[model samples]
Target: MAGVRDPGALTSGQRTVMAATITASALLFSSLTSISVALPVIQRDLGISSSALHWVIVAALLPLCALAVVSGRLGDVLGRRRVFLAGILCFGAGSVVCAIAPDEVLLVAGRGIQGVGVALAVPLALANLTSALPGHRRGWAIGVLSAVTTGVSVVVPPSVAILVHFASWRWLFVAFVPVTVYVFLAGSRHIAESPRAPGASMDVRGCLFIAGGLTLLVFAFERSSDWGFTNRQTLAPLAAGLLLLVAFARAERRATDPLLDLRPLVRSGVSVPLTALAFAQCAVIVVTVYVTLYLQQVLDLGTIETGLLMLPTSVGSVLLGPVVGRLTDRGAGHHLVLGGMTLLTVALLWLAVGVDHRHGALLVPALFLLGLAVPLVYPSAGALSLGALPASARGVAASLQIEARQIGATMGLALMSALFTAVEWDERNARLADPAEHFTADEENKLDTVLTEAEKGQALLARLPPAERRKVHDAADAAFSTALNTTLIAAAGLLFLGVLLALGVFHVPRRGRRRPGP
Candidate 1:
């Protein structure tokens, strides 16, 4: 077996490989996030239902969540380079499919394929980096990876939105094709292939259970507004998904070589950091999705303006990441993690309380603070998670962390969407004069049209009389403010939970040495 290299003392060739891997990872992360700002346009062009629109943005996350552990095991059994290359191919192919997808169904299928590729790429990338680099160098490499991944999400999505303004939404997927091709070609030569461990088997059944469970759960949550939570269409899938997840847990516990080893999750070393990562990711997704909408819808900003507004997040992450990484390497993981989480919580609360139509300026500082907090939190969480495991299980551990991130993102979007929809509904209802006592049929029709028609919703107030317009504007503002606050408060709570989880799960005695490498 090839041994792990000392990251701190990497030869020039190894350093080159690390740089290439980080670049590849960054490209992939940028591709994943670049779609965020384009989502509204996609929804309009595709004529997709609200539920379908949600899936379009989040579908990639589902397979990533389900396949992560399995992909990690594949990395160990099939060789990391082979899996990594295959992932690149898959991602590129999926992008092509998305670029030409004729309808929502085809687009979603393409997105799911992309999710699989992400599942394969992300964990293998991390596993390869962790295995190739030595101690302090590993921390630094991971820091760079975290910074690039998180930073790109903040920067690239809005930039893509700017492109979408001048070009079609199809260009968003088209843009990735060249980058993917370049990364695949360049990385193939630079990265060494690790030999597969003999006698390892893929747990096909475990993969099925997890995939089915997550898909069902995600679908249920995505469609809850349309189908209603109590409807069989929603409840059945959700219940079945939960049952399958429970079955997956049972199967993993009993399997001789489980695809997803549940043992590590039970171990304090692994579980703590993983949970914190999951929660933090949830907060990030919620903030990202809503903030983009807030800029475009509430602030009436164009794509270019929105893109520029989001730049602070990326700038802050780039600045803070390396510093936090150094601190973690110097034995301050707990402090950095705690401080980052606290910053994130404060930012979310500030946004919730202070954000309004005239308060667009507040977004600048809030986003920048979040930018700073994310890099600090993510890299430390990743390093701590990987640090808890033996070398042999690093692939699985990395996959587990990625899976947590995916699940958190999916759940966060679903929850925030539900809140937004509910608030919007209430706002519409509030605008209706006492319907039980003196409502006109035209007023009821207008309200229904606002709720049902996406384009109509935007112009509803514009078409009303001046007196009525004031009422509609006030109601819309109230609704948006309420929804934004609710989501931000929820985000803040999640961040606080993340901090507590980190404190409990990631706590290592100051005098303790690193666990012996597997």
Candidate 2:
């Protein structure tokens, strides 16, 4: 394996590669937040339904989830630099399409195209960065990159808020094009092509199976809340996706040149990090979505304020990133990762049981801890997962981790939504059944019809008398808060499980050893 000539500093070329890849990541991640911030404007400008507006986000995620493994494997079979550049072209073209789009349909189509580019670029970018240096130093690079991107994710919202306030939402799509072009140009000149498998044939059937499976699964979960779990639309796709994934596994086992070689996943070091990362992704989507919902729906905070309030988590990530990286390089990654998971669990429990309007501002500390937890877990888990594999397998290894996180994110959304609805419904029903509540038949009927969690609060309150509204609103808020807290508790449990899994499965090097650690 090739090593960086200087252990202390990156060469000019390595720095260029790092900058281009990290910049590309910033571009991709920032788009999600920018679009989120601009969604209201987009809906008003396009005059689209609430349902249709969601497709703008879903379209991007689907292709990104589906194509990741294939893109990573293609990098190994073809060339990483070549594929990475092509991704830039696709992303830029898609941005142009979105910038010029006149309607929701075209915008969603453009987003899907951009998702394809993301699938190609993101995993390969990591593969390139880690491959640029020797194994021992990869942790620091991953840590810095994670911190930078996390910061970007937080920072983009405030800037996007300003941008959307002053300019048309279309500018959001156009704003990044120049940066994209620069990264493309810089990468073409500076990024070296990774080692490719000579004359290796693409596993066409395996690619089709996994892509089709993941796309279907993601679509099913993304739509499950809206369509209802028992609805035929949801069930049909969910069952089909599972079947296809099973077929994909079978196909991979038989293929001579598989798109995703599954053998590495059986190793304890690799599997533990991958699983832990998946759990972390689940925690992220769950906490972020529910917290945003809490801020907006319960407290009625505006988008900008809610975003700003979420900054402590981002701050913690930035503060701890470099330290986590240094610790990993020193063979302390095992302790850091498990400790991070434990912290995450504690933070989630803190929010779950204690969060309230009176003490809501105190959430800052817990959120800050949440921030600390991610930098500790993510970069370290990524380093461990990739480091466990051979150089030849690193591309696929990175892709596998990406795929797991994507699936985890989708599943997290589904799980939280499902659990919230169930808990909220039971809470509402138990109230309706109580004589102490003294609910009229009309109110009972109205409450009984409330299916979605959002409807339980404002929708019901809007129909009640001013005198009656406050009581119903309070009850609704309590239910919503209860549901939210329950979901957080569930997330906390998962993080605890992640900690246990890492401890049980992963065997770390002893302290005072000079050996490299995964």
Candidate 3:
């Protein structure tokens, strides 16, 4: 504990550790969305085909989500500090690779390397921060970390747009190299080493199973929207993923030092929180995806306006974070989580009812409620899940948290995609059935694909008479609105399920009593 300092006054060493870890967290999470904003620029610069553009996203996300658990266990077996430094190195190297990449292949490979680094760093950062603080202060610190990372996302889309507009897209990757180096140096100096499990060996078989399982699952979900869920490509991977995951569960039970200790899921009562996290994340992702699409396609908002409209959620979360953290520290984690879940459900319901081809700003109140709701549940649920485990297991516990949220996001994307696609297809068929429309098969097919794209849809209808075109445009808008409302209702239902799960797992401590730490 060379750099260790007492928690009182939060010494410079402690401050450095917090600053470094929090900065790393912000950078990593920013990558999740920023690359997407830069995708168009990347495609034009690298001559990347439209089909291959998605791989840019999948390349980074697949490894990040797949290897997260293994990375956490690695930190435990080796030293967290060692793994943390390694992560910084990998991410910095990958960013350098991306900046210089001349083709799509190298760019994608660089992204994959970055994913590996994220998988390594994110959980360890959390573990390190949790270890740095005394039990009483961990919740508040976590809240601040969560707040900054989530709040920064509000600015990321617009920032990336500005950066891409003013300079080369490659600069996006290059600009962060200095920050990465700083974090690495500062972390090496200030972040204390945590307990390395003596005699613990790497769970090689478990790692392979989980990495393969999760990668396949995430791949299947990401592709499901395009491949169709029932298509052989999707079903085959889905089955394989499920089988591999089952095998992983069996292997962990037998391993001397499992990569993931399932007992904690039940013993620490973390299963409930994990379940809540998953369902809550599902709802959150659905809102994010559909709401953005709704704003653009239905309400006819520009990219800048859409990004600006999304700010309420970020602002609400930032403002409410400290209060929620204080309440959680006061043994109100359970109540906060339940209340948050309830509010989330209500917000979703409001969005569902209010969705229309009207002013986009009307959604602001619900979005802000969503922002407030998220901070309450996310940090509290995280504390409830990780705080219940011993320090030695916190890394693995953090990995579990990350994995749950990622899986939830993947599932949400797939679910909403399927629902929305089905509605689109149904709407297309209904239009085709109308004899008065007199649509040809080719025209119907073109309309089917572009129903969600206002520009494309208008172009496709350009050959038609103005009256017919207007009718079709209005119909497409209505269909898109219906799809959005359906997804919102579905998200609301998922949040209700999360509320019930939270109720089962958490209980407020009596007045003047604090919940016991692990």
Each prediction's Cα lDDT score?
0.73, 0.73, 0.73
TM-score of 3: 0.77
For residue 321, model 1's alpha carbon misses the true position, in angstroms, by: 1.7
> lDDT by residue for model 2 over 388-464, one digit each (tens)?
77777777777778777876776565656667766665665565443315555444434522222334334555655
Tell me the lDDT of candidate 1. 0.73
Residue 495 miss distance in model 2 (angstroms): 1.7
Which number leads on TM-score?
A: 1
lDDT of 1 by residue, 168-242 (tens): 888888887887787687668767889888887899999999889888887787667666788999899999999
The lDDT ranking, best first, is 1, 3, 2
**What tens-digit string does per-residue lDDT give for candidate 3 at 1-518?**
67776546687888889999998988886785456545545655665533244567667766665678777678878999889889888888989999999998999899888888888887788889888877877888887897788667777867765676678789889987998999999998999897888876788888788778876776676566557788999899989988999998888888777777776776535777777787777777667656765665567665556666766666656687778778888867778778888998999888877795355556888888888888888878887787677777776777688878877765565656666655655564576454325556545544632434434344567767666766676666776677677778877887787777666545433333343455
Pairs that collide, model 1 = 6-134, 7-134, 391-518
Kindly indicate the candidate among 2 and 3 with the higher TM-score: 3
Off by over 4 Å in 3: 1-21, 34-59, 76-82, 92-112, 126-158, 161-174, 181-198, 222-228, 386-396, 432-476, 504-518
Model 3 Cα displacement at 369 (Å)?
Answer: 0.7
Task: Give residue 284's lDDT in candidate 3 (0 to 100).
Answer: 73
